[model samples]
Target: MRFLSRRLVMPNDLNFAGSLFGGRILEWIDEEAYIFASCQLGAKSLVTKHIGAISFETSAFQGDVVEFGLEVKRVGNSSLTITCVVRNKQTKQNICIADDIVFVYINPETRKPEPHGKTKAELDAEVLDI
Candidate 1:
């Protein structure tokens, strides 16, 4: 798993009630997952093509530092499913925030999905049940 640590909650990240908004954290999930997956794929570049089901299990108020971990769950012919787990760094408790984001690397010139990385370690990683 690739860990994206300590995305500090900002005032703009909060709702009217002063709790961190779900959308902000959700966006971070997709972004971080894409970065992690792209690094794993050794892709020159990648873009999000799909966002799968998502669930938010806790609340993060202002000043909370959120940690999101990304892992490749499955790889298809041209698409990769990246799973992200969000956790609360302050409380040291798991929030279980999750999403399956799909990214396709593009050939800068052709703007198409192109295979890149082929390292044995990256190809062998499995999604942890956590």
Candidate 2:
């Protein structure tokens, strides 16, 4: 997976126990995935269809920075599957990992799934060709 975004845990982002909120972390993961899917597919109309098993390995306290990493796992005719991992920047420890996030391309007017016409191999080639 490619490291995509970083965020600093803050007091306002904490739960009652003073740890980073799981909901906030989920927001970060979804946002990062959306950005990646939009960029990779060259389209802005994307919808999160599913998120698979998410396992939290550790927790972060206020002031700890976290990095979200994502990679394209598969590309269907109209859907893109991404895997994600988040880690503490200071300790370099994995905080959470999730697989099976699926985002689908949509047509704004039709409000229906549309083909993205991309594959992991194609993306890899594009990177290598660069």
lDDT of 2 by residue, 68-103 (tens): 888888989999999999999988899988889999
Query: Which residue window of length 10 is worst by lDDT in model 2?
Result: 121-130
The true-structure Cα RMSD of candidate 2 reads 1.1
Model 1 over residues 1-130: C-alpha lDDT tens digits? 5566668889999988898787787777777787787766767477888888787677888888888877777777666777888888868666655666888778889987776545334577432322
User: Where does candidate 2 stray beyond 4 Å?
Assistant: none
As a TM-score, model 2 comes out at: 0.95
Candidate lDDT scores, in order, read 0.74, 0.90
Q: Model 1: clashing residue pairs?
A: 41-117
lDDT of 1: 0.74
The top-ranked prediction according to TM-score is 2
